[model samples]
Target: RAPEEPLHLVLPSDRRLLRIAHAVLEHPDDVRTLEEWADWAGLSPRTVTRLFRYETGSSFAQWRQQARLARALERLASGEAVASVADALGYASVSAFVAMFRRSFGLSPGRYFDTQAVIA
Candidate 1:
């Protein structure tokens, strides 16, 4: 979680970042593009990146990665398989998802889920 007061909080532009987050959380079936969000937020991509970094204390891509991981974890915990979660999370393929999962947790998804994989 971020601090109470960050160096800068740029999400106040129409609350568009929050809206985009809500949209993703509300309907995972529809993944919104960065361009779409830029339009919705009424800011250029460069400004969006800057504001997103300011508010989240991370680059937009990094934030999106964590968000996608979080969503993947939720779906996985809900009994959804890895392939499905990969598809839903906008991954190019299951292998990509597995790589990311392993990178984040130091264990593959299946082992992580079953508690059989050791953390390196």
Candidate 2:
């Protein structure tokens, strides 16, 4: 995906999967494990994992990461501080958030914003 493009989350047809997706999208900072989420959704962990991959074309972990990244992009575009965004996203540290951002977009948060500014 392009650095400027928004991440698209697929909503599954299954009610259980849909519930989990909505929760993750609504609260990307939630750091619950797949098993915990499954329990909350009244699904077995194996079912959750299998259905997430089958219905969404991504694992639960990947979906949550994308959700978090999407929110991070929105906040950063609105001129939020890196540290603030990192904290709000439940990252262990600014550097950890930066690393994830860099891995995803191949640029640090500051450089990403700078590039975005230039493009705009």
RMSD of candidate 1 to the truth, in angstroms, is: 6.0
Q: What is the lDDT of residue 45 in candidate 1?
A: 80
For model 2, residues 1-120, the per-residue Cα lDDT tens digits are 445554787778899989988988787778899999999999999999999999989898888888899999999989899999999998999999999999888899999888878978
Residue-level error in angstroms, candidate 1, position 14 = 5.9
**Residue-wise lDDT of candidate 1 within 34-88, one digit each (tens)?**
7877787677888778777777777766666676777777788789989999998
Clashing pairs in 2: none
Write down the lDDT of every candidate, Cα atoms only. 0.70, 0.89
Misplaced by over 4 Å in model 2 are 1-6
- The parts of candidate 1 lying over 4 Å away from their true place are 1-14, 27-33, 116-120
- Count of steric clashes across candidates, in order: 0, 0
